[model samples]
Target: MNSAFLFGLLGWLDLFGIAVFATSGALAAARKGQTLVTFAFFALVTGVGGGTVRDLLIGAPVFWVQDSRVPILCLAIALIIWVTPVRIWRAGAVDWFDAMGLAAYSVFGAAKAMQLGIDPVPAAIMGIITACVGGVIRDLLAGEPSIIIRPELYVTAGALSAFSFVALMQTGMDGIVAAAIAFAAGFALRALAIVKGLALPVYRGAAEDE
Candidate 1:
């Protein structure tokens, strides 16, 4: 796709990513019997945490701050979950939502970095960082073990998508097409991990070799 088309796609994806992440954050709080303030805090932090860090590292203004609607959207999501019946969310919805957000944000991060004149390799790294850090922060705040410590293929899923997006875009693939494939591939991998217990090989270091 052309630059305009790519940028337009990125914009929409960015909004959707924020919404999905915010919902997941709010739902996580729901499981904890949190107050409205905690719900909003979790949603806002989980929604904007990674993108905000990515922007700052890239010398761009933090995204949620630049766009007033971002935080408002996060809060709105939190409110929706807070007012709704807890059972309406279903079990493991947060994990599924987070999986999709990871894929979307990975692509978005790479695209944003590329637009900022960053090289493809670093751009892909930015994608992984963007996909994973928000969840890390969210888990820390929730007093849960982060996914990175889990045996499942989490960050690896992000890496696969980010790398694929960067490679495909460099090979002249349409941006939207690249994003679709990359996001699907990543999400599929994560879904497999969720459904089939797929995971990376364990590292048996010298300490464990004995």
Candidate 2:
């Protein structure tokens, strides 16, 4: 509930999220027959990309660089997946990992911003960046479209989680409690979106290009 305990919890969540993201990214590289170098590249980028961006924007030290554990954890996760059977990298596992990463990063971003004395709105936006930038970078490196640009409810889920965290903070809820609720909400929404093919409605302008 206190700031110290809240931060420790956030650190654990961030590590767990990075591991899951790395595993998913490594599995994707393996499926594409990428070499070990490529696997490590994907794992590192998918694990630390979002957090790096968020920290840079906020003028905080780059997290993984500050704590070697993050990158090491990511590599370990990738190695484990690489040695495992291919079936473990099935679509369902990917979805679950993605959901978990989204939730964890959203909470991490919001909590970090709050600690740094950022306003609620910007903090919420930071949360979205923390949740989506890793996936965007990973997809771009994999020669796939960035998920944030797609209508797959990815950013929406992050926004919802971030806003929830901010609202709870404004209401004087403890940081850890707010973070846990925000993570669960985002994860549930993302899982449902994946299952039901849910998406935000797109605007259609009269212009041909639009």
Each model's C-alpha lDDT? 0.90, 0.83
**Superposition error at 56 for model 1 (Å):** 1.6
lDDT of 1 by residue, 80-115 (tens): 999999878778998999999999999999889998
TM-score on alpha carbons, each prediction? 0.96, 0.94
lDDT, model 2: 0.83
| Residue 180's lDDT in candidate 2 | 83
Q: For residues 1-210, could you state the per-residue lDDT of candidate 2 as single tens digits?
A: 366855688778888878878876886688677877788889999989888999999999998888988888888877777778777567567567877898888878887887888888998899889888888888888887777877778888888888998898899887778888998999889988888878987876656576
Off by over 4 Å in 2: 206-210
- Candidate 2 C-alpha error for residue 68, in Å: 0.9
Model 1 misplaced regions, further than 4 Å: 206-210
